[model samples]
Target: MLDKVKELNEKFKTASPQEVLEYFLKTYKGKIALSSSFGAEDQVLTDMILKQDKSAKIFTLDTGRLPYETYSVMDNTNLKYNIKVDVYFPDAKEVETLYKEQGINGFYESIENRKRCCFVRKIAPLQRALQGLNIWITGLRASQSITREAMHLVEYDENNKVIKLNPLLLWSEEDVWDYIKTHKVPYNKLHDHGYPSIGCAPCTRAIKEGKDIRSGRWWWENPEHKECGLHKK
Candidate 1:
């Protein structure tokens, strides 16, 4: 798998995101899937992928804490595309245990608590979403944060034991929005207000102008620790 991932990176190094999506969606078929968070980049990919193959596997993790706007976009995307995106949710028992161990909103107290909440809400559900899949597509961009800048267009996710494919790995923030507007893609309303990044409601917030794209997420933590353990290598 490592050798194959390296080969893919080299072969598609200069290819457009569409070309990469075309090849993999045909070659891998049901073995590949895109995991969207309903953010700008994800919305752009959702539009592109569905245009290529309407039956393409596109899924999202619905952490119970997501904002109402995110849900609204989710509904709008389904209505516009005429496709129902698969949704993965945290286990009820685990969520109950999480609440018992750390009261609601406990993630704001410390980095450890935040990560614990993230693990149950995002990571666990993500693992279920990735099951039986060979390629895990994401909306990750290199400029999003320090943690992701080092990632390649194609790399092996050792934790998930799957090939992680980042189609928009090189897209800029402007590029994402431009595609959204040009294609009339349905996007989260929060982006218009100021939230460049979106996650579970309590873990995300709006940022001031000139801040890093991911700064609004986990604002209390250092830049290096802002990840929710989903895309970490």
Candidate 2:
């Protein structure tokens, strides 16, 4: 799988994002899926994938603590595309135990607590969402943060044992917005108010204009520790 992913990256080095989507959507078919977060980049991918294949799988993880705007855009996306995007949620028992152990917002106290919260709310649910899949599509861009700087167009996610496809890996922040506006894609309202990166309501915030796009997410932690284990290398 690793060798295949390397070959794929080489083959699509100069391909357009749509071209990448078209090939994966047809070749992999039911064995592939896009894990959307309903952010600008993901919204763009959703439009491209649906345009090529309406039956293409696109899913999102509902952390249960997401902001209202995230849900709002999610509904708008479903209406616009006329397809109900699949949603995955964390285990009820795990969430219950998390609260008991952390007391609602214990994530603020330490990195361990925060990671624990993310595991229960995001990672665990994501693992379930990726089950039995050969390819996992994402909206990750290299410029988003330090953690994502070394990502490739296609790579193997050993954590999930799937070929991770980053269709928008090389897209710029400007490129993402341009695609969104050109396509008139439904995006999260939070982006209009300075939230460059949107996640669960409590974990995300609006960043200053010049800050890193990912600065808004997990703002309390160091840049190196910002990731929630979803795209862990």
Candidate 3:
């Protein structure tokens, strides 16, 4: 599987994002899925994927702490595409346990607490979403942040035990926005207010101009420790 991922990466190295998505949508068929957060990059992928295959499997995790703007975009996306994106939620039992173990908003007290909250709310549900899947598509780009710089267009996710495909891995910030504007893709309104990255409301904030896009996410933690365990390197 690892060797095949390398081969696919090399094969699609020069292909457009749309072409890359098209091939995987047809080849993988029902086994492939895209995990979107409705950010600019994901919106671009959502537009491209649905345009090619309206029945493509695209899903999002509702952490119960997302911003209103995120919901707005989600609603707008469904309206525009006329397709309801599948949604996953953290287990109610687990969420109740989380609150008992660490009081509500405990994630802000320390990095450990933050990671625990993230694991319960995001990672665990993501694992459920990825079950019975062969290909896991993401909206990640190499230039988005330092943690993702080492990622390839295609790689094997040992944790999820699935072949991961990053169709926009080589895209730049300008490239993402260019595609969005030209395609009239619906995006999170927070992006216009200085948020380059959007995540759960409590954990995300807006970055200043010329700053790293992902700086807004988990701003309290070091760049090396910023991941929420979804896309582990």
Q: List the residue pairs that clash in candidate 2.
A: none
Estimate every model's Cα lDDT from 0 to 1: 0.93, 0.93, 0.93
lDDT for each residue of candidate 1 in 1-233, tens digit (9 for 90 to 100): 87898899999999999999999999889999999899999999899899999999999999999999999999999999999999999999999999999899888888999999999999999999999999998999999998988989999999999999999999999999899999999999999889999988888899999989899998999998989999888
Cα displacement (angstroms), candidate 3, residue 233, comes to 3.8
**Tens digit of lDDT per residue, candidate 2, span 1-233?**
77898899999999999999999999999999999999999999999999999999999999999999999999999999999999999999999999999899899999999999989989998999999899999999999998999999999988899999999999999999998989899999999999999999998999889989898887888999999999997
Q: Please give each candidate's TM-score.
A: 0.98, 0.99, 0.98
What is the RMSD, in Å, between candidate 3 and the native fold over all Cα? Answer: 0.8
Q: How do all the candidates rank in terms of TM-score, highest first? A: 2, 1, 3
Pairing residues by index, what is the TM-score of model 2? 0.99
Model 2 collision count: 0
Q: Which regions of candidate 2 fall more than 4 Å away from where they truly are?
A: none
Candidate 3 — worst ten consecutive residues by lDDT sum? 1-10
**Predicted structure 3: lDDT:** 0.93
Q: Candidate 1, which segments miss by more than 4 Å at Cα?
A: none
Ranking by lDDT: 2, 3, 1
Q: How many residue-pair clashes does candidate 1 contain?
A: 0
lDDT (10s digit) by residue, model 3, range 1-233: 87898899889989999899999999999999999999998999999999999999999999999999999999999999999999999999999999998899989889999999999999998999999999999999998888998999889999999989999999999999999999999999999999999999999999899999899998888998889999984
